[model samples]
Target: MKLLCWNIRGFGFTGRRRQLIEYLRQEEIDIVGLQETIHQDFSMHELQGLSRHQFAWQWLPSTGQSGGIFLGVREDVFSVEDMDRGEFFLSMSVTDRRVHFSWEVIFVYGPADHARSAGFLAEPKNKVERCTTPVVVAGDFNLISWASDKSSPNVDRVRMRLFNDCIADLALRHEGLGANLGADLRARKGALLDQIKVLDDLDDGQGLCPDGWLRRYALESSLMDIYKSEELFWQRRGGQNWLLKGDANTAYFQAIANGRRRKCAIPFLWDGDVLLESLEDISTHIYSFYKELFSAEPRGGVSLCADFWPLADQVSDAENADLTLPVFPEERMTAPWLRNSVKRLVRYFQLGASAATPLLQCSDRAGRPP
Candidate 1:
């Protein structure tokens, strides 16, 4: 699953939100953790509009004017089992429906204020300590861990040490830039291309040497292998169906995915005479429609016909006892069906040891049903 953790700074700007939404769509992020949203009050519709993705969301509204944290998981990908919100964090326990893997995800916007920083850092540690499942803690930490993280020498070493300690306590590792699968795939593809270029240069120098040609063939094979891996990576990202033998690159799949998303979106719905354009209106209409459609209908009591009892067959106590009797191994071997077993057992009981001799002999032999 692709997760995006971004401090979008202020999600209040219309243009910035539009660009972020476009980026989310392009990246095909399965879960997103957004920080520093300045809005104190907002709805899921507003979030869906801002991100342009259909997802189940939970958020911690901004305190005064500065620190909102939002976490959204694509509903198709995850089933939210539980949700919680803190002063500086929003958390959710989710299960990946396809694979049935469960995890806890926390989106934090750590306090920049010295007074609140300790509590913000400790909150996640406490939350993670109790979790039995895998955990993902992400978002704007607002704490610098090293001198290189800041531009100047004004780094807070105390806060950095505490943040590092909290991470250690939770057993969480940092995933820096180019740490994800897509980045690794791209890096591998680049390395293979570089190797191929080196082989091409050697071929130019050697002219028609057999050794140079052999090296070129080996490099070309490696390049093809990397190309296949890269193609598969993009195909998964684009969520497109695999195409038959052809060199359909990343751009082709991406374009198809974009088009598919557009086609699948429900912008508006007609509620009889009224057109529901807003998300709330459309959703409410759908909910109400289904509720009414499936609502219980009033009906009279069901009655059986007087003649039905006379037509139905009834078994006597003797017949029922025979039907319910447990079949012995000798009888089961002689006859596979329950009816045959009942008749055979009855006959064996009537004829005593002489009639059961053959069945006992068969059981003593191969023990297969004869």
Candidate 2:
């Protein structure tokens, strides 16, 4: 009954497709929902290759480059009864033959545009209501159910209300709602403080009941605990550096990360003497720069450094022969540890190249090698 959901953005690229396959294999997932595939068509061969012929999938192609979704069910585990596809979602009715159980699964990719998001939120209400089996709705809804769901300063109250209303209307449980209850609890505490103030102003010379004050104290304590737990959660997600010194505001941390990313981006780049702003121009400039940089020879002179530290004991002939033995293709592709290591290396290189690109461009513009 293990299910995995991811917004893969695009699965067309070879590296991403390989990574997805590796992840699926490693997690041993029974069912998977992938969003933002961006591919207009996928072949049976490609699907088999991606899933290693273990899972069967149904896909809704993207309209242009904007939206797409896919649902993959483990062929050995579930028998798919029917599939319904939409612009923003895909639903499948499946039965587990072993357990003799049935359920309806929906994978949704909500639109980013506000108006489209609203429509996406409302579109599935009827389908949800009509479903008789246990329904599992999942995917990148893109709309947060509460104000504090986003770390940015710009909290869309209207969108929050729409998202919450949609969930309530559909009678769906929001698993992450506990994280957003901090605000309501804090408001309640504030009202309690105001009531205490009014009680004090009465000057009855009789103190407030211990039970009422204890409840207020307990609420304040719970709020503080919630903040600490949230801070720890973000820290575990590798966001400690972006966290405020004393503040545990998740939204503020997100805003800081977003600001840093914006600041790091190359908005404009100099191509020879021309300043390029368009994405195409910028991409061309980067391509040309990297091509020349990698292809160019040493400017001053080439020098081969001699090995300074040599092994004290030379390898035996048997060891050298073993090293020279050819590696099999199956060994290269099927070895779990080797595949995982290569994937990690690929991810590292990709991230490093992106972060260093702007710095390298700046250095080249200043007539220096980077």
* Total clashing pairs for each candidate: 0, 1
Each model's lDDT comes to 0.72, 0.71
lDDT of 2 by residue, 42-103 (tens): 88888887765477688988878877898899978788898887667788899865433578
Q: Pairing residues by index, what is the TM-score of model 2?
A: 0.48
User: How well does candidate 1 match the true structure in TM-score terms?
Assistant: 0.48
Cα RMSD, model 2? 30.5
Q: Alpha-carbon error at 75 in model 1, in Å?
A: 0.5
Pairs with backbone N, CA or C atoms under 3 Å apart (clashes), candidate 1: none
